[model samples]
Target: MKSSILASAAILAASLEPVAALSEPLQNILINTDRSPIYRYPTDVTRGIIPIPVHSHNDYWRDVPFYTALSAGCISIEADVFLFNDTLYVGHEESALTKERTLQSLYIEPLMSVLKKTNPKSPFVSGPTRHGVFDASSGQTLYLWIDVKNNGEKAWPHIIKALQPLRDANYLTKVQNNETFVPGPVTVIGTGGTPLSQVVSAADRDYFYDGPLKDLTGFTSLVSPIASTSLMEVVGDIKSDSENPLNPTQLEAIRKQIKAAKDKSIGVRYWETPGWPIRLRNELWRMLWKEGVALLNADDVNAAKEYF
Candidate 1:
C-alpha cells in the first residue's frame, strides 16, 4: 500500500505481485489501523507531502483533519468556524463544538509545526525561507479557506487575532499597500458571509476575500485570490447520461462562470456539488477537472487524489 492512506488504489491494484509478501512500508496504508492520536508511522518522513489542487471540503471533519488531506496531497483545506467566549471553535455547528477542538489546536498549531519542519532554521539560508505546507512544493501557497459559520462582523477580528501564530512566524501571505500580493506559506481566504467589506477595507491585510464566481466583474485578484460559487447554483441537478455526457445548457453555464472568474485572474471553486448517484458525482468531478477549474472542492480527498 502507499504510505498515504488510500493514496493510490491504482498503484495498489497495478503492482500485480503477491500481497502476502509485501513489505511493512507497502502494507502501512493497506493494513495500518492504529487510529490512536499518537500512532504515527516512521515512514511519514519518506512519504512526505505532495501538493494537489484539490480542496479538502470540511477538512476538520476528517480522521486527522489537515494532516489527512496533506497526506493525500490536497493543498487546500477548509474549516467552519463559530466564535464564542474569545475562542474560535471548529465544527459543522455549535452543537458539535468541543473545547478541545479549536481553530488553534486543530489547524493553526498543527500548521505552525508543519511549517517549522519545512522551514527549518539554519545557517545555510540567510533568513526565514517561507516554505509552504507541502515539502514537495515548499514554495506553493496553501489555501486556508475559513468559512464563517457565525456572525462575520463580530467573529472576524477574533479570527485575525487567531492568525497571530502564523503572522508572527511570517508564514501568512500579505498584501502591501493594497496593490502587491506577496505570497507566503498560507493564503487565508474568507468565505461564507466573511464580510467582503471588512476584507477590502484593510489596506494592508494578510487575508483576502472569496468572491462570487457567477459575478466577479467588480472584484480583482488583489482582494479575492479565488472566486467561488455553489455548483448546484451554477448547473442545475446533474443528470448525465452515459451517451450524452452533459446537457448543453449546464455545460454552457459552467463555461461562463469559469470564464467570469478567470477574467479577473482568480481561480474558481464550486462548492456544494451533487453527492448521491455516485456516477453523477464522478462525472461532475471529471467535468471540473477537464475544464481546468483551479481547485476541485471535495469531501473525499482519497478519491479526488486518485481521480487526478
Candidate 2:
C-alpha cells in the first residue's frame, strides 16, 4: 500500500509540471494574440478630441480650469490674476481669490504638467519635441491669456517668475533672436493692466502682449500674436430682434479689425458678445465665424462646443 501511494504521488507531480510549464506560454499567447503592441505619444492626452478656434473666457470659473477647456476643445483660455504679497492669485475679482487658487496652482503648474506628458523622454524618441495639448493636431498651440487685475508694474515680475517652470521646459512660445517666432505647446499673452512697453521691449521674451484690436500699428506676431477687443465697443450693441444682426457699419468695422490683425499675421478675438436670448447669441456666433474671426470668445464652453 505504501509503494502504491508513492507511485501515485510521483505521477500526480509529473502531470502538474507539464501544466505549470504550459500555463505561462499559453497565457502569453492568449493575452498577446489579438492585441497589437501598445504605443503612446506625448500629446496623446487629448487624443480623439478635435480643437476649435474658441477662447474660453473666464476659464478659471470652471470646476477644472485647464482640463475643462482642454476637454471642451477650446484652444484659448484666460485667467484674471492679482498680485498679493508677491504671490499671483487668479480670480475675476479680489473677493474671488483664495489661497489655494493661485496663478502657479491654477495655470502654470497645470500647464507644465500637461506639457511634460506631451513631451516625454523615451528610447524611441530621437530628440526634443514641442507637442501641444491636442493630439489630433500636434502643431496646435494653446493660447494662455493672463489679465492682470491690478498693479501692472508690480505684478509683471511675479508673472514672469511664475512662468519659469514652463520656460525651463521650453513649453512657452518664444521669439528667438528677436526675429524667429517659434511656437511651442503654449503661448502666453499679457492683457488688462499688462504694460505694452514691458512686453515689446523684451523682443525675445516668451510672453506676448494682447494689443488693442482697434489699433495694431507696430504690433507683429513677435510682440502680439493675438489682438482682442470688446464686440460692443467695436461693433456696437445688436438689436435683440433685428434680422440684420450686424449692420453695414458694424460689418465694416469687423472686417477692418480682422484684416488689420491678419495682415500683421496676428490673430483677432472679440469679447463681451451678447449672452442672453439664445437665438441672437447663436446668430452672432455664426456671423463672427463667417467674418473670419480668429477666436470666438465664449463664456460658456459647452454651448460653444455644441455650436461647432
Candidate 3:
C-alpha cells in the first residue's frame, strides 16, 4: 500500500511539471506579442486603481495637475483660479499666474479630452455614456473645487464661461429647477472667494458652492455636496504626543460640525491638517476615518494612497 501511494504521488508531481513548463513560455509570448488575447475597455486608463476619498489639496501645486490626482485615485481636486482679462488663469496667487496656464488649458480641456476618450463614439456601445475619469468606479463624480481669488463676482462668470466645453458634453453635474439633482462625470464646486448669493440665486446651475463646515443652516447637498474648513481653525492646535491627538473640546467641535453636515446629507472635509510628526498625521487620519469624515484632505496623495 505504501509503495502504491508513493507511485501515485510521483505520477501527480510529474504531470504538474509539464503544465508549469508550458505556462511560463506562453506568458512570455503573450507579454512580447501584439496578438495577446488581453483586451482593454475604453476607460481602462485607471483600470487597476482603487478610488479613495482623499481630496488633493491645492492640486495645481503638483507636477501634473489633474492627471497626477487622477493617477493617484484621488476623488477630489482643488484649483485656485484668478480671473485676468476675462481668462481664468490657474495659480496659487497672482505672481504665479501665467498666460499659458489658464483654466481652459490646465483643467477644463484636459478633463474634456479624457471624457471624450472614455465616452467613445463606438458602434459597440449602446448609447451616450457619462463614464467618469476612474475606470474602477465609472459612476464616481470627480469634485473639481474652483477657489476663486480676489474678484469672485467677476471670476465666477469667467469660470462659468470656461466650462463651456464640458457643459456642451453634458459632463458637469447639474441641479435643475432648483431641486432636481443630476450627477455627471465632474462636479464643479465654488470655494474660496466664491459668492454664495450668486450660487444659491441661480435657479438652474451646473455648479455648487463649498458651504461652511461649521454653519449648514440653509445649505444642503443641492448647493454644497461637500463642506470644508480648516482643522486648525475649528479644533485649535492638535497635541499629537498623547494617545488622543485631539483634546475633548477639539474632538467635540469636529463631531458637531460633521454631524451638522451629515444631517443635511452634505459630506465633510477638513484641511490644514498637521503634516509633520508622521505618527500624529497617521493617527489623525485614522481617527477621521473612524469618526466618519467623508473625505480626507491630503497634500501628499502618494502617502495617503499608501495609508489607505
TM-score of each: 0.84, 0.86, 0.88
Tens digits of per-residue lDDT, candidate 2, 76-132, equal 999999999999999999899999999999888888777777777877879888888
- The segments of candidate 3 whose C-alpha lies over 4 angstroms from its true place after superposition are 1-40
For model 3, residues 1-308, the per-residue Cα lDDT tens digits are 99999999999999878554467877887777655435446566678878899999889999899888888899999999988777888999999998998888889988998888778788987888898988879899899999998799878988888889999889989999999999999999999999999899998999999989978888889999999899999988788788789988888888999998999999999999988788888899988888789899898898999998
User: How many backbone overlaps does candidate 2 show?
Assistant: 1
- Expressed as tens digits, the lDDT of each residue in 1-308 for candidate 1 is 35565757656776876657778786885565576446754224414566778999999899899888888888899999998987899999989999999999999999888888777777778997888877667788889999999988999999999999999999999999999989998999999869988898989999998888888878999999898888887776666556344688988898988887787788889899766566776888888878879998888899888777
- Name the top lDDT candidate: 3
Ranking by TM-score: 3, 2, 1
Clashes of each: 1, 1, 0
Those runs of model 1 whose alpha carbons end farther than 4 Å from true positions after fitting are 1-48, 240-245
Q: How close is candidate 1 to the true structure, as a TM-score?
A: 0.84
After aligning candidate 2 to the native by TM-score, how far in Å is the CA of 1 from where it should be? 78
Each model's lDDT comes to 0.85, 0.88, 0.89
Models ranked on lDDT: 3, 2, 1
